[model samples]
Target: MPESFHKPVRRPSSMFDTIFGGHDPADTARVAHSTAHALLSRVREDPEAEVVERLVAFTAEHGIDTIASLWSQAPARSLPGALWRIYLLQLMVHEDANTSSIIYERGRHELASADPIVAGAPTPAGPDEMVALADAILRGVFDGDFAVALNRAASFSRVEASGATHLADDYELTEPERSTALTTKALRLSTFAADLDAAAAHWRAGTLT
Candidate 1:
């Protein structure tokens, strides 16, 4: 497993305080969903390069927990949920590009699908390329076709899940515990892939929210 996955998630004290300080759950959900839609609208309506860049870099500067707090609880097919998944995917790559690239490489070889192409990753994507690919996918959400971006994320997740499963098999014989952990990770990634793919379909059908 990547060291980044072991790192403790940092939740800002102020945000937790606000969440626990009498803020209603319904109100929080409303704000989260509305804010997600509003942010997407703002970028789509006026997608200046500078504005897109700033939004793309928001989680990098503020930490994933900031947006995770707001949107993590949203329904999987909703706008906020889709946005949260995309940010989470980007964080995974940015935090541990090396492991991501290795797993992706394995999946590229094992999986007999067009996922690698849909994911828009370079052939033999290295750590640096993986990071760039993650950023590009997030940038596409703000500046390019939203459905396409979601599809790309879905494909990426699927490929990684496939890779993780195969790696688990490789470790099953000698390292049972590691194999079990990889299997669990693969299952989680598979779920994310399904949700992201559904979200993409919803977006294309004009019902993402």
Candidate 2:
């Protein structure tokens, strides 16, 4: 585990804070959406590689809870929601690159689709490759193409989910608990794939926000 993962970071209060008249739900949503768009807009217009890299490493240095506080509540098909998912995916890979690489390799071998190609991961996707892939996908969101990045993420998720499912099956007999956990992970990854795909479509249609 990374030292950052062990650090205590404060999570902002949720919309539920509205119950205590702390934050108005409408205001919170407005701020979240505006901030998400502003950040993306700024980086895209800057055309600085360093700027993009800084944004890519923002969560790692400051903690994902910072951005999650802003976008976590957004709709899964919206821009803020898509950004949140990408950051979350990056954080996961960074926190457990070895495990991520193992499952990704399994997925690359088991999946017969073009997803591995679409994901753009290097062959044999070791831990370093997995980390690099995560960063590249995120960099695409800010510097390259947003919809394309989402598609890549969706494909990656599908491959990983497929791998997890197959691995779960292999462990079913002797490691029931591990199998069950992998099964759950597969289901969650599948859901992420679906959501990201939908988000890509929404982005293309100019309705992601």
Candidate 3:
């Protein structure tokens, strides 16, 4: 066969395959990844960003204190970047805290693992889902769901502990600057689940060595 005539093989798309490419979709790792994406999407999004409600109503709801206050002019490290870090970390906590959830985030890192906020890369929050979440929060707030917004705000407050201090009017993480690599504090289980679960699922499927 001519070298130019070779055709590429088509691969099947499973939840794992789509989320963690080259891995078998049936593995637990993928399950974790899927769950992480789904759960985080809910909590991070403004409408469903109920980090506490889900954690409390669901399971293992800790670290709700870490979230930074979005409405506060108290001076955060930076603006949008700070928001991203807090939410991303919360997602990790959510994945890890789940016992039945196969998601694992050890040695492995999630999106906030390496801080490249300056690259201005688009985040899940910037997407339509988050937009909707935010919209829902706004609508709900007017509809007398202030308590709901407050709860979501509470769940991610611990993220502020990640260090988003204000230099001037804008937000900034004064202590540990966000870069390609960030030195995080004692990590929460919710912050490390999805990645670990994805790895385990891959191993379970026997796709990875």
Q: Rank the candidates by TM-score, best first.
A: 1, 2, 3
For candidate 1, the 10 contiguous residues with the lowest summed lDDT are 13-22
Alpha-carbon runs more than 4 Å astray in model 2: 1-23
- Residues 148-183 of candidate 2: C-alpha lDDT, one tens digit per residue: 999999998888899889999999999999999899
Across 1-209, the per-residue lDDT of candidate 1 in tens digits comes to 22243345554443212222216778778978999999999889989999998877776666766787688777878999889889888877877789889889998899999999999999999998998898899999999999999999999998888998999999999999989877887887788889999999998899888
Per-candidate clash tally: 0, 0, 38
Give per-residue lDDT, candidate 1, residue 32.
Answer: 80
Residue 134 lDDT in candidate 1? 88
TM-score of each: 0.88, 0.88, 0.21
Global lDDT of each candidate: 0.83, 0.83, 0.29
Writing each residue's lDDT as its tens digit, candidate 3 over 89-183 gives 33333333331011111111232533223111224222333223323332332233333432333222222223221111122244334421222
Report RMSD (Å) for each prediction in the order shown. 4.8, 4.2, 21.3
